[model samples]
Target: MKNLAESVNIEAAEIMKIFQWKGTTDQLTDEEKTHLKYEIADTLIYLFYMCDQLKIDPVDVMKAKLEYNKGRHWKKDKE
Candidate 1:
């Protein structure tokens, strides 16, 4: 299996391509959707590696961030 950093880098590159190809209508081509999946996977791979390096658990961090954001109750204000 490929290592985490390599996987993340590969996915990050795909994300760049997606940005380059995005449509104005908020619709995505099938290939773009597939690339998006890879982009998310790549980000997760990097997050996991960073957590491991810091001796942290991914789930714990995720839960903590979720709780923090929930408490903040962020929303977009309409103009």
Candidate 2:
């Protein structure tokens, strides 16, 4: 497997190709989906790096956000 930086570069190129070939955003081909998978993976890799730099745990942050959202949607007994 390639390193995160390498993946990011690959993803960037694929993104450009996506825009160039599939001008219309309404639909995408199988090739586009493949490109998108790489893009998402690249984004996640970058996000993890950022989290590391900031001294934050991505897993914890995600868990906190999920818990917060769950509480927000919870109904009160009085309702």
Candidate of highest lDDT? 1
The global C-alpha lDDT for each of the candidates, from Candidate 1 onward, is 0.76, 0.73
Native-to-model Cα distance after best TM-score fit, residue 9 in candidate 1, in Å: 8.8
Q: Give lDDT tens digits, candidate 1, residues 33-77.
A: 987897888788786886788799989888999988875644563
lDDT of model 2 at position 16: 71
Give per-residue lDDT, candidate 2, residue 52: 77
TM-score of each: 0.64, 0.56
Cα lDDT tens digits for candidate 2, 1-79: 2465665576677667766755464687787788788787777877677677678899999999998887574567448
Clashing pairs in 1: none
The CA-based lDDT of model 1 is what? 0.76
Query: Over 4 Å off in model 1, which ranges?
Result: 1-17, 20-24, 73-79
